[model samples]
Target: MCPRCRGEALLWARVPYGWTNREGGRVEGRSGVVLCPACDARAPGAAALITWFHVHGRADDEDEEFVRLLVRWATGVSVPPLDEHAPEAENERWQRGDL
Candidate 1:
């Protein structure tokens, strides 16, 4: 679920950014991307994290935790933590439409 819109089908992407020379030479860097299919909201690049923190963070400590969770989710290394106050089973509940 997306933190901003509570959308169920949150999408992750790696968009590219950076400089391109006059001759069309390019230097690209990857951006973190999260898209809310339900709302058509887009969170892209480092700005994504900033937006997430601004919209979802409850305390200073939550900032790092959110980032870590997002990274894990985006990398497919692990599932992202749901609401900090909710138990891990909340994700299961969400999938079961019990949340």
Candidate 2:
């Protein structure tokens, strides 16, 4: 059972991090974190990242898209811009008086 959410199917992962400083100094480390897929609760180390992907990876919930949106908010991943184009098929039908 997960301490946070009391969920049974908790997922644990060791996330790795690596970075290089301006002087070419390399730093790397890993952190162990637990996630509750049932209730979207994450352990301490998991908070440093957007753990939605791990928590919701196995979910078949109908609200998955909403979850995705929330993940984008948490991760600062921007939503793709919508294409700006007229409905050409509908316009053509209207011009032909088919509507």
Candidate 3:
């Protein structure tokens, strides 16, 4: 799940097909689903899709940030707050390994 959009439900099943980098490099990686959040409030089809960018045997943190920013820009809504209503965060008696 994207750290920015913590509250939104992520669709982590959309595989990334391709990606381009800031240095004009194109790369491919293992096919896997993307983690994304839907912005139904602003638009019906607004979504932030997280994709992996493998460049020169390394993944850039900037690229990941860019994807996150892109999603917010496209959706026009701030990423939902994470764990705002989670029961675990609010529970004081729950132990880490209680489950």
Task: Highest TM-score: give the candidate number.
Answer: 2
Write down the lDDT of every candidate, Cα atoms only.
Answer: 0.52, 0.49, 0.41
lDDT of 3 by residue, 1-99 (tens): 544456544443333344556687875533433234333323323332222222222334467665564455344433233343577554643665444
lDDT of 2 by residue, 1-99 (tens): 656567674445454555666688976756544454554434333343335455555533367664554443334322233233457877888999998
Clashes of each: 0, 0, 1
> Comparing 1 and 3 by TM-score, which wins?
1
Q: Which residue ranges in model 3 land beyond 4 Å of their true spot?
A: 17-25, 30-44, 47-99
Top candidate when judged by lDDT against the true structure? 1
Looking at model 3, the pairs that clash are 14-34
- Against the true structure, candidate 3 reaches a TM-score of 0.23
lDDT of 1 by residue, 1-99 (tens): 656577664445574455666687875667655545444333323345445645774324356766664564455322232243577677789999997
TM-score, one value per model: 0.26, 0.27, 0.23
Clash count for candidate 2 is: 0
Candidate 2 local Cα displacement, residue 64, angstroms: 21
Judged by whole-model lDDT over C-alpha atoms, candidate 1 comes out at 0.52
